[model samples]
Target: MTEFSSILSTSNIRGAYKSSQELTTSPVAPEPQGTGESFADVLRNAAQSTVETTRQAEAVAQQGLTGKVGAQQVVEATLELESTVKVMISMRDKVVEAYQEIIRMPI
Candidate 1:
């Protein structure tokens, strides 16, 4: 569906290509042949999401402090930050451990 070249080969076309009825689906989606998103794109998206989450968390904390937000809002924000931080830290720890383990092993 992403590219006509991928779905209907340039050489020939028999009938309408139905994505669902196909006997099997591809693990990788076909692109327009050249376009690609690098690893940096994914990291950028994730960083942006984290920034937005942090902003919302801060807003909730500020509102609660100013008595504009309820206790629930404050609690929810705290929990969100706690959970996000926990996941990030765990990921970081795993990456670091993997790197260290790799360094200790002979090539």
Candidate 2:
């Protein structure tokens, strides 16, 4: 019984040591893949979308003025343009804030 207990304890210690070694030598978290569009691409897309929305709103307004479109269509386009402008403004403010924060960081 003493011999068996000694062997068991030794095996347990060996297993624990092996696990600690594995933990220390394991690879770190993987780097993010370059599979997605970049920040500049995202900003460019957003700007394009905003411009398109504004153009659509203007077209709808012109159509309404010419008696070709209904008031509902114009109102919807205007609302969409308003929301897009608001979002763009908010994004700009955030980017500016981030830039300021970065600039204020100690070198």
Candidate 3:
């Protein structure tokens, strides 16, 4: 896991140039500096990540609850799942506020 994390760090991933035979590259496109983004985009990404994390956690829980994995693994997975949920709720609130402000704007 140490080697995996070392290779997966943002700096390490960004350091090496992509080879010609590589099928895929960076996970995200470059975010332009000092430019604002649409609230919808932010919310979309947050929701997608949350769903993915929750799915993984459920898989881990199933493994543990069925005696296929350790209890500690289940606890850690549950914690990660909770954190993702909190993030989604915060994003949802922000999106709602932005929508309300747009609605109140005068023509």
Which candidate comes out best when scored by TM-score?
Answer: 2
Candidate 2: residue pairs that collide: none
Candidate closer to the true structure by lDDT (higher is better), 1 or 2:
2
Q: Which stretches of candidate 2 lie over 4 Å from their true place?
A: 1-31
Question: How high is the CA lDDT of each candidate model?
Answer: 0.56, 0.67, 0.61
Off by over 4 Å in 1: 1-45
For lDDT, the strongest prediction is 2
Model 2 lDDT per residue over 35-58, tens place: 555567767777787787789889
Pull out the clashing pairs in model 1.
Answer: none
In model 3, which range of ten residues has the least summed lDDT?
16-25
Alpha-carbon RMSD, each predicted model: 16.9, 25.0, 10.2
lDDT of 1 by residue, 31-83 (tens): 66457655445445545655666788899999999999987667666655655
Model 3 scores a TM of 0.60
- Which stretches in model 3 have alpha-carbon errors above 4 Å? 1-41
Give a tens-digit lDDT track for model 3, residues 40-89: 55556656766777898899999998999987667666766765676567
- The whole-model C-alpha lDDT of candidate 1 against the native structure comes to 0.56
Which residue pairs in model 3 clash with each other?
Answer: none
Candidate 2's displacement at residue 95, Å, is 0.5
